[model samples]
Target: MAVNLDKPQRWKEDVARSVDMYNQWFLNFAPGAFRATRISATVSVEASLLATSYLRDIRPETMKKNPSILSMLRMATCPPIAVDRLIGLAGVNSSLVKAMEKDNRLPVRVTGDLLDKELQKIGEIIERMADPDIFVWLARGDEPRQEEIHRAATIVADRLCGAQANPIIRNEQEKRQLAKIKTWLEARGYNEAETKARVDFQNMEPGTFSFRLNVKVRDNTVNIPVDAVIMPITANKGDLPVLIEAKSAGDFTNTNKRRKEEATKMAQLKQSYGDNVNFVLFLCGYFDSGYLGYEAAEGIDWIWEHRIDDMAELGL
Candidate 1:
């Protein structure tokens, strides 16, 4: 059955409701809650061994004075020196002093006035392997353990440096939006089973279906995964599946690129599915003029999470 597209007023209301729900949830979001979960997993023994070996001889007094180098050492995820490479540079089984380069781990360059340049180089190398942020923990005068260094390194690498650091928050938002969409679909006579959290069509004929929609971003085409979909248990010869893409964002800035990306994805899906599929963009927050432009340009049918009453217009 063909879907309805004439309920503009209802669509607006749905959008407003969805935005309100998102705003309410965002207000209570605690970033620290996510940060607290960072150390749930333990670091590998190999990594700990490497970290311990690197920091063995560094004096606590020197580490405190130049904490930046200590911080780098604590955060280093991988061994800076490959065993083979180290052996080549300092001779096989050489002392730690010969292994660290003179300028390797020191925050400031060591002058010729300093005696025993090799030992200073070793100290600097140890400092380079540790993360600076852990210096506060070290300031307590507790001897650094290999596992502690490894854990701090993991936090720095995965939480501080990684994109999507707090995925739990994003995931919760997606789940909320998906639940809202599923509720709307069920109220409009779509079977609860038909509206699912994740939908995959892997074994379908090669050219006839795609699990992901691709969009051109800069010089590359990026694939956006469809969060959910509604498929009839038994399809009439001309009946098409309804594709749902749900997005939740705090504000326009965070969603601009995503909004455009989704629009591009919708355009591609429409081209591929033609009359055989329907598309709905379920947005769970506020959008600005730029978002509206992309939505209009793509000719996408969208509904706000709050104003979900428009689902009735689908006439399923």
Candidate 2:
């Protein structure tokens, strides 16, 4: 019932087509998306540099008042270091710095005293590692030149861009994919789920679809956040809703690296519920034949974004 999956020759053609489509989309939209993200990132980085006194005052007290500055501190360095590198240089707990960079605060386990001590160590590390030329305006006792500030912020913003998972593009792709799915499902009389809580999969009403639904395992201890779930008009209370993962990739490398995640999720689903639980991938972007082969071997099936009508194969 799956399209192009049973025939290797046909699947290869589909992969080429999908890759071409993704490339075209990227060529058209990715630059604008990156520019928008970079502009916002540059503004934030500029503000951070200003707040840090142009990297002259990374004192413990300053850091204590604003742990979020730690990220800026790392970026302000000559060759901007990663979070882990900063932690290593400071000889502090990795979680402390990682928490600060990620959540802009220390973890709950870090007490006030511990936070002060950690901040002192981190501040000393940044002070030692701060780029002298970048902070040269401090020695002159004058405001940094506009161009100098802009250059510093741009470098930091560029580094931040590389370090991220490219969230902006991914979010846009998800929005578009979800919107398409919504239109397709609605045409078939599927209604959106009213509540945002964990979906009662077993008792899902007929012809219902939900976005970002939480489905718990048999023990109810862990919940899996599904991208979309749908119940067909023919389904009864005992039937499980159809689970779909909306996936996109910018490159082949990441898809291959992350291919195991889908297999793991599928294993968890079948282990918790039953083999009959339907799980599918709604894929776009740079998934290649190797990635497809891996997913297929794991008993997982996918519907290409180029061929979304293939969702009917799952009886949606």
Identify the leading candidate in terms of lDDT.
Answer: 2
lDDT of 1 at 101: 27
Clashes of each: 22, 0
TM per candidate = 0.54, 0.88
How much is the lDDT of residue 21 in candidate 1? 80
Alpha-carbon runs more than 4 Å astray in model 1: 1-18, 29-36, 39-129, 132-168, 183-224, 233-235
**Off by more than 4 A, model 2:** 1-4, 61-66, 132-136, 145-148, 165-168, 194-198
Summed over model 2, clashes come to 0
Residue-wise lDDT of candidate 1 within 218-301, one digit each (tens)?
Answer: 334544466655554344445555566776766668777777676666666656555344677767776655565566556666
> Candidate 1: lDDT over CA atoms?
0.50
**Residue clash pairs of candidate 2:** none
